[model samples]
Target: MKRHITGLFVLSALLTIMACKKSVEVLTPSGSDETYKVPQGNNDYDNTIVDYYNKYGTYMLYKFTEKDVYWTPTGWKKPTLPNGTWTTGAEVEASDSAYINAQLNLIKNKWFGFYTDKFLKKFLPAKIMLCKKVDSVFTNYVFTPTFTAVKGTKKVAAFYNYDNIQVNYGDATVNSMTAAEQRLFIYKVNLIFMQSIYARGLNAPTAEFANSADYNTAMTTYAQAYGKGIIIGYSNITAQSDWNAFITAMVTYSAPQLNASVAITDQTAAGILNTTKDPSGQIKRRYNMVRNYFINEYGVDLQLVGNATRGL
Candidate 1:
């Protein structure tokens, strides 16, 4: 009995030791694992990219794959690169390496110079992809009397350009742009910024401003939809689209221009030549609301941004 009891004690100790060994093996992490690293060419442009990342947490990606741009929808198969042989799928080509520096300069002077550092850090997307071009293809099926046939088509759909803010930087046109053209480019980039801000529900106006009866009445009454509490003719379709148009106008036109637009008296059937006047003062009211919201909440004056870009 004593011998048997001693054997049982030895077995118990060995079992405990084995269990501890197994636990340690399971808990230990691999030391060789590393994350994806951005390439460093040790050039000025690469240094600027690194500086932007360090300052604003935004990756100025000029060299990236299509996976970085296209997002896989839920329950949908993940997309793969065509490897230079694609007939029906999405693809994105990286910007020309030579033009990367010029594009970076344009972004620095026009985009970063306009906004405060704090604003860019907070509002800019995590990745801003600069591409030469982006394209996608879809395959449609048609049924004939005898059999089913497939039709492959190539097109650039907005859906293919998913999460990141993509800028198509074509050739070295930055150096040749006139002052007015430069300002227009600035306006377009800033419009993207404002659109992203609105889409994310960050620093947006309240429902009181967005859904106001005065604004709605003015929008519905006017046919042209400009200078009457909205910015574009298509804005009359939906309140959300109207807000987008309003933001577009705020970033595109100066305060004086918009105010002048509201005061025009000559009437026309096509809503041009200052035909759509704001008699109810709703346009002015909503304009003030939008301007004030940006100023009070973000310490940003939308009119000032527009005015600066417009060279006012």
Candidate 2:
């Protein structure tokens, strides 16, 4: 009896060891063999929100790349490169080739005038227009309306279908030539364009547009600085009825979902920033909420804004 009892104890110990080994292996990443662990500690999301909105407002630009695409709609097969291929210089130029023609058509159609089209007529200094071929299998790209840059009687320097892009109007104080101004404009334009396209082309067009309120909030906040048109970005929300609904739910109709760890480039969140007052006096800033979530969840580093020439 004593021998048998001792044997049982030995077997149990071996089993426990095996189980622990398996657990350890499960926790290890296959490629790097690194232990995967989520970040701990609560982040000050509310503070981030107040600070972000107080400065950038809701109308800032956002860029959506392959990294931004996630949780696709039902029955919608996402692309391997959901963000689409990056356009080459040659391709970027080809896309711009038609800018002059498009502008002329818009002018002829009376779509633009001194008061009505004043926003579109601004000569974008050093503009980069990205476009995709028509009817291309570029669904994942944040595809939006074509953004073309045109000069008076000059051939369009750039025209291309982008997955998404945006254009914003600012007060004369926000000059396009300033680096900060340029960065802010480009980022906001890209984000706004993305949202717009998503609403129009996704599965549920109307719903997507309505649901993208948070996104719009960000744009609106950004727009306050410029004193003119709001943020405009591209979107592919209306590719299908279901997709539109999904995106809308994700944006306007949903609660603030937070991402802990988001990638932040050095350019955006570096150094002392010139936080602009929320000119509109609206406290809510969509971009701030989004950024807060990203930073809290992912520890994304945010930089401060300062002088434009200071190579932030």
- Candidate 2 overall lDDT versus native: 0.29
lDDT of 1 by residue, 1-312 (tens): 999999999999999999999999888477742232444466667888888888888776776665666543432323332353224334556667778788788777777776677778888876777665544455445556645444444422111233456664535655577888777667767876777666565554568666763344434434345445554443335555655655566677775565554433332212222333665566567667766776776677777667767688
Q: Per-candidate TM vs. native? A: 0.62, 0.20
The digit string of per-residue lDDT tens for model 2 on 16-97 reads 9999999997785666622211111133322432332233232111222322122123322222332334212111111232
Deviating ranges (above 4 Å) for candidate 1: 1-36, 72-92, 133-160, 201-203, 207-220, 223-242, 262-276, 308-310
Q: Could you say which candidate leads in lDDT?
A: 1
Residue ranges of candidate 2 with Cα displaced over 4 Å: 2-28, 32-312
Best by TM-score: 1
Model 2 residue 137 distance off true place after TM-score fit, in angstroms? 11
